[model samples]
Target chain A: MLFRLTREDWKVILYNLGRMLHLLSFVFLLPLVPALFYRELDTLSYFFFTSGFTLLLATLLSHLCRTDEQMELKHALCLVALAWLAASLLASLPLWLGGACSSPLDACFESLSGFTGTGLTLTVDPDHLARSLHFHRHLLQFLGDGVGIVAVSLAVLGRTEVSSLLAFRGEAREEGIRPSVVRTTRLIFGIALTFFVVGALMFTLAGIYEGADPGTAFFDGICHSFTGYATGGFSPHSQNLMYYHGLIYEVVAMVLAVVGALNFNLHYALLTGRRREVFRDTEVRVFFFTALLLGALTILLLLGKGIYTSTEALFRRGIFQLLSAQTTTGFSTVPPLHLSLVWPLSLLFLLSLAMLLGGCANSTSGGIKSLRVGILLKSLALELKRPFLPRSVVVGERFHHLKDSPLTPPVVRGAALVATSYLLLFAAGTLITMAYGYTAEQSMFETSSALSNVGLSCGLTHPSMPAGLKLTYMVLMWMGRLEVLTVLVLLIALALSFQRRKAE
Target chain B: MKRTLLCLLLCLSLLPCAGATPVSVEDLVRGPQEWDGRTVTVTGEVVGRLERGGHVWLNLLDNGWPLGIWCTKEQAEGIRVVGDYFHIGDRVEATGVFRARCPEHGGEPDLHAENLRVVLEGRRVPRPVNLLLLALSLLLLGAALSAALTLRFRRKEPFLGYSPESF
Candidate 1:
């Protein structure tokens, strides 16, 4: 009750935050290459200014907070929370300056969406955006989702061993593959690189097979691979995957999304020759079963009303949409208007469930995560078994993830708390959207898509959308990306800080 | 006989011409079934092109949203300007069979063009550099570089007693 975070506590937080800014200064400069390539060099000054400004700020903050002190768990938590907001704010500068966004808030929304790997966009007419700016949008996803910003900053630049690892945990990427966080980050980066190389190559071939020139194919291939493996759905074309109009390209995207969403621990097991974890893991089973249920319902709905005539159409439009949502990847073969206007309500609701029950935990995908969902369901089953047991009998169960892990009370409760928080936030976002005169179904669909960090939209997201809704979805994307608790901690810290300020 | 001929002419006038009654791509996307397999006219700026064996795929941008059009190579050859970062694309009107699900190409929603005509020639999009914006950019950039350079060379002089390990 007496807890008060003094300014002294923020010294370490701001210091590490500056370390993150050091990496971000380079991020701002990334778009300049594409600008040069596309001959949009007139806009190059914006990137230079943003990069230089960030570098100066980072230098200043580091000097101000310079001390021979280490961060504790609380400091790490606050740093992770503060870093995302700060990075998004700094990241929006180039986007706004490039004239891609309609307003500052819209650019901020796009920046957060890209930074969180939430593909929702308010960038006005992305189809006409400058080439370098378009590349920056995709690059944001690669840094945030593929190589986690927190993990990379801490692993590469963080000086303190204990606190750096704590920051990794606070970022929800603590499933380490090695003893040291640096080694783990390196291994993860290696895995991501291997996948990116292979995926890009395959996508390029697919694009060529579908009748594209080498230049466009190679360009789209590299960019798609970045967002695809990140499970961060962003595309240069406004039409998303429908721009390709190729079945093969859609297939490649689906495979990449699934690969991105797989549990990293399982990937480690398979690399170490423990191949059985693919089928034996409880989290993996939950993901498949849920996918199967949702996919079947969606496909059945498509076929029931004669949405398409042939198998190819069914696969590209129907199956692709379901898998995209299940992976929490926002790539769509259908237009937003089509999804909102023509798709059956039941199918939209099914897609909502798919988005809400996203891929496995500790993966790039976001939702209540498969492992948590599995634990909650198992706990429910254990309770169901209670009525038949003797009064004194205490039943305990275990589920296999990377190994056999007990369904402990704390684990179940944590899962429940997170799930409850997600649903409540979903409700709040839906209510705000409804208050703006959208239908209940439309509100629910868009809210879940944003809160689950699945970038799919049902015609509710656009540049002309209410700014209030834009702020709401931005906050939702941030909270959902961090799995709520980190943001909640930041909020409580802010409140306590203000209370302390008033008391003084 | 005169009345019958006049009535036929009236009916003919009721139907839309090749360039008339241009259907909205958004409308077709929202209600594909209603327009599926129907002959329709569409007008948009040609933005991108992809060559097939004998045909070419042109992405016609209607107010910044793209609608794919499958046209013969001859039709695509007439397109002199394709839009990108630098220039406005050729504005063209095409009469085609709008497919809700094109079976030939992965069931993608597209139009198979029967006729094409360029209505407007595209030119270089005006990109006037605002002097005010350029000035602000230079000033901010200058300030940033100066700050970075000053801190790098003289931070130790200000805090000479500070330990290097602290950072």
Candidate 2:
């Protein structure tokens, strides 16, 4: 299986992976700033060692596997999966070595969660965690989702054709904003930067107003902004967003989450004076209506149960969770246990549905994206209407993304396949969790969370969870972030190559 | 007879004190059935707060899962800073009735405190600059900068050995 790859193919994979690691090494250095700022000397040492080691390894690989060949599609797919796995392992170094996690597996889980923008955590006593380490957690989310490491790597390498292919393989919908991949990546970063500044300011003011000190508020503001804008829900505090307890803070977070969940293409169109695109885009319409409908249902369910009697509580707690789930941002105003215990099964299922159908395509939010959901729903409606139409009539379907693209049979089939794959993955994870002695509701909720890349937990994810289950969730997160297909392709490629090797 | 009455009075005085069971935060979190609706005394560092109308919700951590401690605004007034990433919050002892599922707070696990006493005052955590690490970081950064500039001057991309528009 290993020999199935020619030297050139190995070079293509290793070289690109090395370039990515080289870029990632600089990111490791970034946490050092926070470490130094917080005067966390012990934590600072870990960052230094990890960064140096990563840089050294990257240099060695790049030098050894020097190649001029462009990456093939298979090589790109395999590289994308391997790079993410490698990055997750490497990133866990500081966490493990610093004694933040109980074991290397725990460290890897946390790192995978951060890199995949899944907010699940297994850190022991996050309240007492070093400031620098907390900052590093959120920074990883920013680097992983906000500024995609693969996209940034490709942008830096200036590989246009390969960059386009890797971007799609990495689950980003590639609609180039400019002629060059570098420019498009820059544009994405630019948009994220603008949102980061604005979000940080809003959160900072809200924190200060809510009785936090100026310095603490500012630190939290920057950290939360990164995670929030990425729709990556890793809070510095163990209590998550509920720690702030300010209505203003919650509202600002919601705004940032919704904005982050929006499609980057739509962001471009809106930013470049195509205001009508916001309303005309099918994904946007679907996301908006879906959120509203789910929000209403959640509020009614909570009210019916008398969980929160007041209108204020209904909107604040009920609607907030629905939005958080829908956006795939797992910021919780209520405790996870409370959500699991008090919420009706139907409400939990509804939230699971929201998670299963996540935010826009090419955005940080995960799951079978709104684009696919819209396509599938439209296709279903067309199928139902076709049978009732006159025999002579020809029914056609089209949907507006960047433009009105015709929804051909290939598009419908592709959408159906991906969505079905997601459902099956969710079901498999649920069964595995159930076999581990968790209740069906908890298993389904947690499985949906893992598969959708939504980090909301019903108390199933813990530091002491069975090792097998933890590994299951990690694989789910990885596959979820990659949109399942790329990981599938990598797996299939490996299998085929192994078979070929056996034949040889 | 007077001595016997005196002894009984002393015994009665001790009963009130003994009534409040001292328990770990973890015990209360795990065995809510045994402790719920019962008076318990817990000692921990006060962390994070949510201000309600007349009271505040405080999270108390003692090297275990954080347990919510609900106290009046007047009771919480003594806390200067809540434990967080930057500051160490006050360590305190709370005597309260534990509720496994608080009805008022939407089935949240909480403690309704009758009394709270600060055991230790929290202060701003010291963040002295580490000169050794700082120097090393600066050195590494400088080296990286030098390498990038060298690569750029050599007409190669700084990070990836290709011109920006070449592709």
Candidate maximizing lDDT: 1
Poorest 10 consecutive residues by lDDT, candidate 2 chain A: A163-172
Candidate 1: docking tier: acceptable
Candidate 1, B1-167: lDDT as tens digits: 99999999977754445344468777777778889888888888877777778988888888766789999999778899877667788999888898877888767778988778899998987666556766776677677656755664565422222343444
Residue A82 Cα positional deviation in candidate 2, in Å, after optimal superposition: 1.0
**Each model's TM-score?**
0.93, 0.88
lDDT for position A139 in model 2? 85
List residue ranges in candidate 2 displaced over 4 A: A1-5, B1-42, B49-57, B68-74, B77-89, B96-112, B120-167
lDDT of 2 by residue, A125-237 (tens): 78878878888888888878887777777667635566445654565455666666677778888999899999999999998877666786798899999999888888878
What would the per-residue lDDT of candidate 1 be over residues A1-504, giving only the tens digit for each residue? 655567778888897887778778877888888877867867787787788778878877877876567888778888998899888888888889888898889888998888888899887776667888888888888788777887777777777678768888888775787888888887788888888888889889998987877877887888889889888898888888877777788999999999988987777788899898899999999999998887778888988977766888778888888888889889999888777766788888888888888898878898889988999999999999999999999899899877789999998999899999999998998899999999988898899889888899998899999888899999999999888998888788889999878888
Judged by DockQ cut-offs, the docking class of candidate 2 is incorrect
Q: Which 10 consecutive residues of model 1 chain A have the lowest summed lDDT?
A: A1-10
* Each model's backbone clash number: 0, 0
